[model samples]
Target chain A: MSLPTHTPVWRIKNSPEDSVVLDSSDEATFALTEEPVPSLEDGEMLVENVFISNDPAQRGWIQKGVLPERLYTAPVREGDIMATHSIARVLALKDSTDQRFKVNDFVYCMTAGWRRYAVIKTDPSACLPVMVPQNVSPTAALGLFGVPGFTAYYGLHDVLKFKEGQSLIVSAAAGAVGNVVVQYAKKVLKAKKVIAIVGSEEKCQWIKGLGADVALNYKSPTFAQDLVNATSDFVDAYFDSVSGVILDQVIPRIKQYGRIAACGAISGYNKDVGKPTMGATWIEVVTNRLTIQGFVILDFMFPKDGSNRVATEAFPSIAGALERGEITLDGTEDIVEVPFVDVPKVWGRLFTGANTGKLVTKLA
Target chain B: MSLPTHTPVWRIKNSPEDSVVLDSSDEATFALTEEPVPSLEDGEMLVENVFISNDPAQRGWIQKGVLPERLYTAPVREGDIMATHSIARVLALKDSTDQRFKVNDFVYCMTAGWRRYAVIKTDPSACLPVMVPQNVSPTAALGLFGVPGFTAYYGLHDVLKFKEGQSLIVSAAAGAVGNVVVQYAKKVLKAKKVIAIVGSEEKCQWIKGLGADVALNYKSPTFAQDLVNATSDFVDAYFDSVSGVILDQVIPRIKQYGRIAACGAISGYNKDVGKPTMGATWIEVVTNRLTIQGFVILDFMFPKDGSNRVATEAFPSIAGALERGEITLDGTEDIVEVPFVDVPKVWGRLFTGANTGKLVTKLA
Candidate 1:
């Protein structure tokens, strides 16, 4: 395949103050500019980007200050290429020493920044080959067979150890990661009941269609009482994506020895530093003997053992499920795709709860 | 053994409104009264109480209203005997089909109320035999080889799975459970460092004497910075007996994959019902990938399975350690004993941080 001499890439213009949703009057928070493609160096492979994932974590990456040092990747700063996971096709390879990926092969770039083309290292340590089964759509690789899918799988199966016949509750059940969590809990784990907590009636209906036994709109005036009534028997596990007052309400209803997977705290993503995020009261935790654990998907992908379970276990399982038509993308009606140039505006949809399914930008 | 015709017992005079520490103008929250000894029924055993344990949980048990249903034992009601654990001698037995205990044998009663004599069920389900080593003092059975020691052992070794060479932070390090936690973490677990967060200078020195590498007076104005300075490498595990703002400070300094055993929240014990207790922000939990679990010792003692690990593991291990003089009670200087009549007054010492070690009332 022939490649263009120049490719357009989005660079963060300035750090966001609170929320990543940029205002129209504010100078471009992310600026699109064309640059000459650099020649590939030894051990590097050039890729033609197909799809760039728009995740809720993008809000945290663009925050004004640097995040405190931790095990995960560092926050993106001004003048940096807006960081994202991208599905791309390898156009050319410079080094023959490493044979993990070859030219014209489709690959999943874990750290592919927002650009039309990404120059990634050919070493298996840097990227992995993504094989989309013949019977499945390519978009399945971006959704149910991707990082979001693996997060829901590992979080419930590995972290929470969700068992068959146990009841589960998921907050933000209509979002990308949460959608998969609800499905996997109901379909794969055979959970007795799957309750979905969402923001709007539309999201409630959407998640309900995806096998949620009960859907409660958190915006309803009687939501708290509704939650209590719905979970009269109490839930055995809670997959939390939205923390804050939602946690405060759900935690009291968690059964004794219930496990909580704290996957994301999107509610506090935009809050100022040093300010306490609203959370479940610790008194409930102690009295109920609850176990709450926070996790990041990256840990499973690049564990210390050098074994990538996602490639060996999750990907094959999810891909086979998609190929068999057990998991469908039909319910994800609000996955609005925008041109690469309009990435900044579409990115804001994540925080506004306007976009459904997996939000991704199309790049050719 | 002969039983008294009349037994003196402490019962709740009225539920505490704020603090269990009764004010001068207030009626006695716990009142000492004399009652006729009840005759033993079939399958019941009469016990002469020796040592009744005083725990911080006493404050919560005396609260005015009914607690919301959860895993923990409910509060003792007005006109009811205050509940506590005690070491007592079996004075007499009736219809003792199960041969777990005989007359004059010592046993640990999980439900021996605050009384001079208690009528207990002889069923193995009710109480278990307590074997005190010849070389170990009887007090060792009430302290290091008892509930406090078992809580520390199970929480660190089982719940937190604390490994050697890892750092630990313990709140209320001078109290009964906290004392054992610090000693076990330092001496048995061989932790790299043990940081003790206490309330007073006396407690600072006391816990330091118990082998705490660092003791920070939480009341110190510069305690937060002192914590940062002391734990330069960040803590790997925390045994939290006192939860409140202290959690807010320590949580931010926890290393990635840090574990927290939420044993107690003494700071909020006397707070008004329905008021929120301050706790570690959940954002840090997510960002740090931390695991926080709440536990009570009774769960381990009376687990659904008939196996009681506390009896088979903790008691024997702790008793052996005490017999070998590996664990000492020398620094526990504040175990001030008073007459049973002064129980209500001395009970206030717990909340006031005026007493240390195991605060037990002498009933014989």
Candidate 2:
């Protein structure tokens, strides 16, 4: 197979403002341009990017300066391909040295840039050969069988060690990670009560369809009272992705020995980096004996030995569930697929709550 | 052995204000009075209290009305004997039904009231027979080999699971639990560095003598900077007995996957029960991925099955250390032994930081 002669890529200019969409004057935040495809070296393969995963973490990565040592990520400089997880198809293999992947094979690359085509090392450590199971779409790989799915799996199973019949509250329940967390907590973990906090009535319905026992819109004026009423017996575990006010409200309601899986703080992502995000109080933590753990899925996926349990266990489990129709992406009507040029616009949908389920941009 | 005909007891009259001694106007916070000793009933024993343990948690228990459900202890109601740990000698046994304890035996009781003599249930579940090692003072049973020692043991070993070569920071390093935590972290766990935070220069010296690698007065103007300088690599585990600004400052300096053993929040104990204490931010907790656990030692000492690992393991370990001269309390000059009648006055010493070591009152 011949590789494309020219590939279009989105490059970061300036960071996005605290808004739903990049301002017109901040067009420099991201620019789309076409360039000649670079030649692949030995043990390299050329890939046609199919879908780019949009996540709240992207906001932290694109910021201009060095973040705190704790929140540190490789800075996404100007004119560089914005970093993301992407599903791609191997268009050409430069050498026959690597036998794990070949031409026409679909693969998932953690280092996939926001580009139409990428040159990825054929090293299995760099990318994995993705076998799209029957009846599961490639998009589902980015949602239910992807990073978000694995994050929820390891967080609830390993971090929180969520027990059967325990009550759980998930923040950002309609988003990529939260949706999967709600489903897994109820369907897989057998959680007694699954309360979901979302931003809109539509998201409440969306999360409810995903097997959430109770879904409350945080935007509702009765959000605080609704949370108290829903979790009268107190939650045994909390999966927090939006960690500002939601965390503050949930902290007091957590039962003694409750576990909190701190996945993301999207509510504070748009704020100035290093400025403290609100909601965590030591008083509640000490009084209630709560255990809070923050995690990044890559730590498990790319461990010191380079063996990824997510690929071996979480992905397979999610795939098997999908094949059996125990889990489905049927009601994900808001998974908007925008063209490659509109990557910036689609990425902004995450902050504005304009899109739901998994937001993926098609590059092919 | 004949029990005392009359016993002097301190009972709570009203709560205290901010002072080193209970205000005369609030003498109702506690009243010392002589009363006829109650005769022991079947399955009961009369004990002549030798030493009454004073702790900062007393402040929370003696608070006026119903505290928030989180900080609720059975309130030390007006005219009730203030509850505390005590070392007592069995003066008389009413019946021979329970064989675990007998007359003249020295035992430690969690239900020991603030009285010169107490009528205790001979039920093995309510009290444990204490074997005071030769050359080890009976008071040491309430300090180095008691609740504080066990708290430090389980917190670091089981809760935090602190390993050798890891760094640790301890708050309230001069208090009963903090003192034991510092010594155990250094002498037993072989931690790489042990940073102790206290309130005074005397406490700084006191904890240093207890094997802290570095000791800093949290009251010092440069305390925060001193903590950062002392723990350049960040702390792996924190044995926090004082949670307030110190907690706020130390949370950010915690390394990834750090553990915090929340033993007590003495700094917040004197404050209004329900009001939130400052210094713990969720950003660092989520960013650093820390685990914070609040613990009360009784939960471990008297677990649901009544089989205590503390009684079997920690007590023996501390006794062995004392017998081997590996641990000593000879230089604890700050252990002020106030008269039993002055219990109310001395109890306020914990909040004011005017006394140190194990503040005990002689009731014999």
Candidate 3:
């Protein structure tokens, strides 16, 4: 089989001070001589990637590691591949013994890259059988049909244990995952009220279009008071995707026996700053009978077995809901395709806030 | 029926400053004069005094309504009679409707006291039946066999679910409730280690005698470090009867899934002088997977069929162990017997820190 002489990559150079600043192109980036095409050994396959995902959590992954105890995601050495999730087609296979994939078959894989092609070994931890929906483009798997969707689904339906008639307060409610949570809490769980806390006034209205019962602009100085008045003395569950000063205000008002699912800390992701200063309040968890748990979807979501079998069974209903327009993606549902060479520029634009939804690079 | 010319009562003449000072002997205290003797109605009996209990928590009750939101206990109003647990004799019963009691019976009744006689109404919430053991003194019901013992028994055995070969750490281990917890955690629960945090070196050694594996004086500068060294990374449960600077140190070091049964917050009970501070730090809780619950005995120990069930079940084993000498109360059990006239002076001495385990007044 013939191989491409040059591959592409995007590197996050010096980090920025804020989200808006970091997402923009900086003078410090570098794109040097691309490495030669590598061979696939046993248990490895060479794949031409079709689509790559850019998520808000990717900002967190760049700044933090999988676990808090880890120093960073990259290897201790300086020149290491960063982590990413991509949908790829198998170009060549080394192991005839492996039955999960065949040459030219498309598979969703989580490996390092904005690269056009890479040699990936069969990861024992990751398995792929669910194909890209025939009705939707392959890039749709990167956003609503992929990690962000699963994270939103499991967080609301499982971790928060969303009950009917309960009120759910979700920060970042206009973003990719937040939009899904708002719809899931409303349509699937029949939540009595869904209070969307968004960064902007327009985004607040945008989330309301996605079936949110109420939307509030967190940018307002009266945000905390607005939340208190909106929930009407009852906030049963809090889905916290952006934890910062907003979380500090949200915690005290949660009703008795309330649950706060700490999904992600995106508010501080772009800032490679020191740990956030803590609020000096004792939460009196018992008096309120509160349960707060931190979880990552990958960490908690098991394979289609055990307790997660229920999640697998419910996956279709969630997907069906999305497909039938019961749950809607508000912005840029179409894949924004660019040549494989523009991956870094797209990534720079991603952090700059110029792009909306998933950014995928097409390979020829 | 003849009534006494004067009756004794402990009065907080005014809310005390930083320090707690009681005046049971001040003649200027609301005088009990020219009032007709209270008559016993049906379901009620007249209890002549035997012993009255002095507890540090009494100060907390006096500062705020015992139940912050609801008046569960009979109100302890200013200029009203002070309420306390007393082992008393049923001198007379005007009506014999309540099957639980009869005239001339030695009954343990919690009454408004520091007096010779009290007309106790048979309010189930206001009083509890004390079964005096032949081997144990009537005064034991005033403390070691009363609420303090029950608190320790339920909090450790039931709430903390104390396991053998696990360590149990308790604050204020020499205090009435804490001393019982030390005995129960060590002898009854058969915990591998019991660490007691006490105020002084004297109390530390005293707690150590009551089967505490290690006792650290909380007042010591290196107390937190000493506690850390003593446990050596194995702290399964923390029975926090005292919440103070001690809790601030113990919390960060607790093992994962550790249960903190926060029974009371005695350290900050009297805030008469200083401003109220932050309640509890939330980050330590999130990082540790800690379950901190503030509860009163009433929340769990609902008696089945009018028998104090926790007492009937847990008490037997505890009492049997006490009888067999498997558990011993530290010889510092200070039993102060005062005449009917001296009740006022003894009440004044309680907050001065002169008394220790089970301060009971005997009337013979």
Candidate 4:
């Protein structure tokens, strides 16, 4: 097999913080160039990027002064190759003695970057190229079975201490992690009530179909009153993904001793993301004895013993539920395909709400 | 023993919210009047106030808008009798069948009013007159063995999930709850390092004497720089008593996965109390994966079965430590004796830092 010497890649040209707000659509902010692909060391494999995930967090990654670094992942430096999570196909192995991975095995890569081909280390170590389960679609490695899903799992179960029959609420419910959280609370936990907040009516409808008892369009003119009418005065738990205005609205309505899993601050990711945006005040937190926890999935993703936290703990249970048809994901509608070369502009669509679905660059 | 027919009492006249900030010193805000004492009912006891506890939270309970009602206790309504936690001597018992109390028994009262004499209830029900231990001075029932110490115990052990050997920081370290928190962290928990934030050098010295490894005067000109130098980049836990400027300063210096016990908002009590103060941004929370909880000692103080969470759980453990000399409290210096008629002015001193001590009304 012949190995490719040059790879097409994108790097951060201008930082997101340099802009008034994060504008991923500004092509000048991203640089597309060709770079020599370095030879892989032992335990590393050369993989072709099959599907690269374009996440809302990407806006924060290539930015500064918005969300601080080390929230979920370290922010991509000003001139660093843009970071990505992707499904990849192994093309060649670096070590002849390494039998853990065979050529053409589909794997999930954490540092895939915005490249057509990359070198990633595989199993027997806790690097990248985590083998994708063959039983599910490989694309799920970048979506439902990946970081987004794992985030939902931990936020709902571990962070929120969610219990069965409790009423739960989620913001950004149609987004990658939010949808999974809604499904898990409604279907798996059998929550008495699950309310979801989304930007558009279509997104609201989509989440409601995923078993949300009530879906509120946050962009609606009557969103605040709508939330009040929909909620039974207060909810037992709140899974907050958007932490600006919606957070403020949800704060007063959370029941006393309510648990809030602050999974993401997507709404403010383009702005100064993590300052206690308007509504997440200490008053509500104290008055109600609320427990607000901010967590990053990656913090729990890798264990020092070379075992993957998600692979070892989350994937088994969630995948089993998927196979049993107790919880379903909208595979056909929630994913958008973009050409590998249109990376920057297509990635920008995430913040613009141009498409309310997971954006992925398809290379192979 | 006979109960007094008329009791000299104080009632909220103007309400703290009537001013720009909580002005507990405004004499016009309180009205001292003589009221006919109500006859005792079944399971009730007539008690004479011995020592009334004046807490920083008193500024919160008598105000509106600054803090929402139901923070630690109900906000004192205008024209309502002033509330105080006190040490009282039982004069009479209405329930002849009740063997829990006897004349001259010293007890802790949760809802003792700012009056010379009042009617409370004792055991077999969750009314006031919680029996005080015989081993400690009855005065300790309103100070070290009372609500302030209990607040510190729960905030340290439960809310912050504080562990021995961890670095801990506390604000208002010489005040009612803060002093106990500092002592618990340093003397009881054996923390690696304990830093205290107080307003005055006098308080700084007092808290240092109590066992703080370092005490920073938040009122100092170089307070901010001093904090950065004293903290080894970050601390493991912060017991935040004053949640305005001091809280903002401490947030960035807390270590990864640090816990914050939001005990009180004394600094902002006179301001817009519970909104996101300047420093507690979600950025710090998310990046650190922080668990910030706001709690009231009262919530746990009462059980549906009528047992006190504090008396049952916290007192036995802490009082035993005190008796064993594992920890010591300042008896002479930290308690300020206030006259009964000076309730409004004395309570205001709590906010002004006029006296860095637990203010108590010695009615007897």
Candidate 5:
């Protein structure tokens, strides 16, 4: 089958000094030019993106200085397109024997990320379930019902094994994964206290609205002390999204027999040679008998048991709670779904801690 | 029974700096001093020193700073004697019904460390034990068969969980714990390869005598490379007595899922507060999946399922092997078995690394 002529791709120019800039406004050197889509091969299907995911991890992938192999989702070389998540429709099928995909059907693909038009060489359902859930938005398939949600679930429920009546502290608690983590810890884990440590006061309140018992501003001068005092018992489980001074401080305060699931170190990605001064403070981990496990979500819910198994195992208990209004999403009260074209600008603003609610970029 | 008022006791002065002094001549500080002996109370037994154990850990206990609390086995209050291993004869008993003690029998008291006279309050039976073989001096019980020996055993056989045919690396391999650690790893644990990292070329030869596969002097400029080259499989277990530059290097080279029984950090003890920058390089712990557990011999072994259980469980097996002369401590063949009076001098020499072999101060 012939594919569309134009494919939208995002490119990173020079290494970003601190934050990733996606729009054409900044001095970022590279560009994701609209290129002519190649013809599909046998056993291949062409997918048109209906929703895309923007992750802080992308900051690591696009930056030239970051180790090339860290781009695990898809190998991104110089002049190649940046990678991210997107749910797309199978606009064309190259092989009749390809029983996995229909031409008009929708499928979810993670490796085939960011690009508007992709000539997927193999069946997408082989990686993640391709069957579209009725009533759930394609963007929801990329957000709450996707990798971010699974990461929050597995890290909290499995790795941490957080028990009831314990405090959970999350760093970068306003980001996509962080928001889901806060809600999961509070509602599903039945934590006595769920505290969100974010970069701004507004982000703190926004996370607090997402069923967090308290949201402490990590940017405040007294943030560390405030967190220490707020969670005086000290955290039973720490979900670290940002790894820097916050990690260094939080580690020393974790209670005996505490667990920490370190998913990302967003704080160090931009630093030239991010000498993260933070350490396990071995004395503390020993004295407290703490266990910290570093994990990538891809290691867990991928290849075989992807999101559906997690959603199936997870959603039953949470879905009823959600339907009963026991669990909630922050700023779900005032939803703001922006168009796909606004992604770069919205992503730029997201890092500034300006967005208050779930920021989903819609493509129809 | 009234305690003898003339029993000499040496008290560490109130001034932190005055408690420990490094001598320019001979380089040995007294392991124990002759001052007024400790007074006895109810339910306490006055134990006359039969043997005293000197460990590299004593250096840390007298260390001026770095959390002075870390320096003491028990708090060395203004007038209290420093505590350590003492195989003592019970001179006077406050209670005849105290089954933990018998008037003339010998018992090892941990709290009465490095002293000639100790009045231990607990049931003396509850303290650590050693049955002195008629041919082997009670002092040998302190060095070869007691705390140091137990430290080596627990560290290798328990903490690092040494498996037969695995590589083992022990720092300070000529010192008391290191000397015994290397022997046990090679002869008892049946380690395939045991690489001992020591201070001097002479000490390397000494460790070689202990049945080490190879002994490497860490002082060499090529120490890290030499260590890596020597241990082809990388270290399966790292028995760290010295946690300084060597450990900074070792932490990186540790094999995947390696175990570090961090018994002591003797390397950084001398430096004043924050003076010694211990480059931990803990990221290696995460990436390589290493487990570094710090332990005081007392803390590491005494509690339930701690080193005591390890000591009782492992000692007999190794002792049977040692009895057959399968394990021996004679690499350097330099032995400093001095009178109690020479302790201060020998201990001072210990810090300067002048005296070799286990310096066991003999007490009659």
Candidate 6:
């Protein structure tokens, strides 16, 4: 099928240093442009994005600096479209015999960059463009069953080997991934106590309702003491999102043989050489025999072994729980769903702690 | 049983700031003294040291500042007897009915300090003074089956969860623990390739005999490039003993899902605040989804759960392996067995790289 002549998109247009943390207002940093859409080929389908995800890792995918072949997902080069894991619709399927996809089917498009409409492959070997399972909103599909939620799932279940009745404390607890981790730890994993650290008091209250035993604002004067007080019995596991002072604060508070799933260092991503202010303390790690595991969601989703546990494990667990009404995305109540034009601006809000939970944008 | 009125001993005489990295020459840092021996109580035994183990962690046990009531062994404080894990002869047992220890038995005495003779407990609740398994020399028992060897056992088996046929790399390959790790990985774990990094060509040659596929002298000018070339398939596990610039060099060379057994930071032990030259790089840790675990030998020896895997698992395995003569301690060939008086001098050699393999002093 013939595609549209042109489609609007965003491409990085700055030096590698400034490529981190997108700011749409700065045209030099990120340029909004139009590119002619190429006609679809066999085994390919045209997908129109309905909702797109914004993650803190984009700050590390500095244009021109990110590796060309990162096993699963390659970072976009300068002048190329910025990538996002999005919920898109199969607007047009090029192959009549394609068993993987159908026209008008809602799909989880893995490589759906910033463009409004793009061609995505639906071959057997392709990792994304899977049908978004039945009866879930685009928000739930992208936010709950997407990268953010799956990251929480694997980081807890696999990395931490989280056990029931074990206490868990998470930093950036109001974020998309962090919120899901907090809820999953308390509701599904049956954590004895869940300590959620957020940036503001408002976010604090919001996360507390999502099964957090104690929601402490990291900005408070007594935050450190509050964390200490809350951890009467040192935590069994920690889910780290902001890795500067917050991670340093949590490290010493963990008990012996405790686990830390280092997911994101959002606070350090835009720094010089992408280094956090304080290096993760090694003393506590050694003295307490802590296990610090760092992970990216894509690894589990499209694993080299072809396990695809994200497809087989996380998606089913989250969807089943949602279906059984076991757990709700209560923390997503204040989600900042922006329009396609405001993707750049809302992304900036992530750094400023302006957004509450999963911050996505409506593309169509 | 009657014991000697006094026993010659060594004690920490310096301030806590100067406690790291032992320097016996500095009389102010470590001083020879004598402690009065008391009559043995019930379940107590008088033991005379045969061989005493010297470790880099003694530097961090600086006199006066170590925390008391640590879960396992407590660090020596200023003016107290400096402790050592020694093979001590059970000179006198207070209880003839004691099942854990008997007089004349060469026991693995956990709390035997740097002294000619001392008293240790043998109760069921007591953690140490374990009867050394028969059929091994003092060096073979302490260096090959003691803390150092068992450290390699659990670090690879538990922390790294290492598997056969996967590649492995280790630093300080000629040291007491590292030598065992190199041999065990190739001879026991059946690793496809084993890379052993050491300080000198002489030590490198020695480790090669211990089943290392490739032994690289880290001090060579082309060490970095040499390491890169050696990791053709990228290593699956890294057992770290020296955590300075060497650890930074090894992190990026690891494959995805690499496991790091953070055993020792000997290079940083005497540094300011016990910090290494370089904080472990976090970028590669996160990108590659690595798991870095730190552990202390005592934790496994006398675990909170009372599993005592060190006794139940490591000792038996090492003893059985020795019985079968499957592997040998070739790296401990250049042993420096100093007298009790020369300990102060040899202990300082650990930092200058003047000594090889295990550094122990004969004390009777």
- Top candidate on lDDT is 1
Which candidate comes out best when scored by DockQ? 1
Residue A95 in candidate 5, Cα distance off native in Å: 1.9
DockQ of each: 0.34, 0.26, 0.12, 0.33, 0.16, 0.28
Checking candidate 1 for backbone clashes, the offending pairs are none
Q: Write the per-residue lDDT of candidate 3 for residues A170-278, one digit (tens) a residue.
A: 9877666777788888987888889988877776777788878889987798887897788666688898866656776776666766787766656555444213423
lDDT per residue, candidate 2, B256-294, as tens digits? Answer: 878888877676555542234222344567666787777
Error of 3 at A340 (Å): 12
Q: Write the per-residue lDDT of candidate 5 for residues B77-147, one digit (tens) a residue.
A: 44455555666777887755667557787777777655666667766443544554446655656666766
Fraction of native A-B contacts kept, per candidate: 0.51, 0.40, 0.09, 0.50, 0.03, 0.42
Ranking by TM-score: 1, 4, 2, 6, 5, 3
Please give, for residues B82-194, the per-residue lDDT of candidate 6 as tens digits.
Answer: 76667788888775566767778777766777778887777543324444457447556667777788898988898888889999999988888888888778888889999
Estimate, for each residue in B112-140, the C-alpha lDDT of model 3 and write its tens digit: 46556677777765466666456666677
Candidates' C-alpha lDDT: 0.78, 0.76, 0.64, 0.73, 0.64, 0.74
**Model 1 CAPRI rating:** acceptable
Write model 4 residue lDDT over A1-364, tens digit each, in one string.
6899989988877776533222345546777789999998987788888777878767656665433423556777768888887777888888657666678877677776788889876753323445445565677777677778888898888898888999988987877788788888888888999998888988887778888999998779999899989885579989987766677678777888888887766665555433453233445666678888877777767645767677777888788778777667554224556666776666666676665545566763
Better of 1 and 2 by TM-score: 1
Best by TM-score: 1
Ranking by lDDT: 1, 2, 6, 4, 3, 5
Model 3, C-alpha of B83: deviation from truth (Å): 6.1
A1-364: candidate 2 lDDT, tens digit per residue: 4558888887776665543336446555787779888888998889888877888877767765534576635667677788887788889988658888877777888676888888878776568766567766777677777778888888899888998999999988888888888888888778899999999998898888889999999889999899989988888999998776677788888898788888888776665322342223445676567877877777776677868687698878777766666677776524556677777788888887777778887753
